[model samples]
Target: MTTEEQTAVHAAMVAAGADRRPGGRTRTFHALLEGWGVEVAGVEEGYAWCGPEFDNDISCRSTLADVWPLLPPRVRSARQPRLDELDERFRAATIEWPGRGDEEQWWMWRIPRLLVIEPGDPYEGGWPAGWTMMPFPKPDSVRVIT
Candidate 1:
């Protein structure tokens, strides 16, 4: 975490009265970020991407409002910004999949079963030899990693 993020975290803790007495969830999240070499946090659940930075302090399922207060200046926005060319007005805000096409999304969503990310190529590694190439799933649940 950058100095800014650290400060934000501290302020959030104080404001929320988070228990930061060591070995807590917040500490754990910080440890993960340290281990992952995430320098610039990106697209947090609440805050917009603070420009391709790494963040372990927040995750998906986090309410946009609750974490909004802790967001750094870089990501704070008065209105939610439209990412890429996603037209929220024309598209349903959420999508679900049963590994099959849904008629409801045929015209509204860029849909069907989507492979969220296609790696440049599949990875082939075993433990310490190529750990960085491991197929890692980023934090997805609402629970904070820290």
Candidate 2:
């Protein structure tokens, strides 16, 4: 990973509230990535750790898919099996969500339903229609409602 990418990863980790001291979340995630033959210092591993922490389960999968093209062929080959296993597990655990309207189908982990709201909608107060909002960081484009 380039210095900029590594810095981004670290920043993401901090933004996600990961403990970065010894025996912290960063170390644990790096250890798991290392076992998958990913370089512990690489952007791939850093992103693999930060994505899920900073966002959600599907975000992790999507982030890895986004980064896959940047990996070398040999690294891709080495990581494919593990990634496939994770994909299978995620698929097995996921269920289709129909709450986000008919035009957009979202598949999420088999937990309580979550709502994702885009920006520019008017808001007044007290849980839009009584759905409790989760305390997630809202980016400029979207807010995750859990």
Candidate 3:
């Protein structure tokens, strides 16, 4: 990724409190793992450490698991870090995000797993609103196009 793209993503991560020292420095998922005290360095073994249940669940797919090693181990484990570890918030995007109905389904964007960031209350029928990349966002969550 370009430095500009990295800065933008890191800025968003910082704004979301996922990453703190978010200026000029390079940002990658490995950096997050470093903060977690996981020895991710020299892990050229690819997804071997990811193990079996990595993405076996039907809700998740093998293709998604392809990016597993690229993400931080904590994110890979999908859990909260120790108090001394980085103060980052993670939701299953389904288990943690707000939704309704007997359905275990959540709709973000992916076809199988719909854990996307929609506007307003989920019960109110927020959805995959149309959007295109832009320089800035509007004030209202619905009207603001990314």
| Best model number under lDDT | 2
Question: How many residue pairs clash in all the candidates, one count each?
Answer: 8, 0, 5
Deviation (Å) of 95 in candidate 1: 4.4
How do all models score by TM-score? 0.24, 0.35, 0.21
Query: How many backbone clashes can be found in candidate 2?
Result: 0
* Candidate 2 local lDDT, 1-146, one digit each (tens): 55665555445445544425345535322333333333211222222222233234344444454445554455567767887765444334332232432322132322222233344433444323223343342222222332
TM-score of 3: 0.21
- Better candidate by TM-score, 2 or 3: 2
Clashing pairs in 2: none
Score residue 47 of candidate 3 by CA lDDT: 16
Regions more than 4 Å wrong, model 1: 1-5, 17-23, 27-60, 75-146
- Residue 109 of candidate 2: its Cα lDDT? 23
Which candidate do you rate higher for lDDT, 1 or 2? 2
Worst 10 residues of 3 by lDDT: 40-49
Residue 131 local lDDT, model 3? 20
- RMSD to the hidden true structure, all candidates: 13.8, 13.2, 17.2
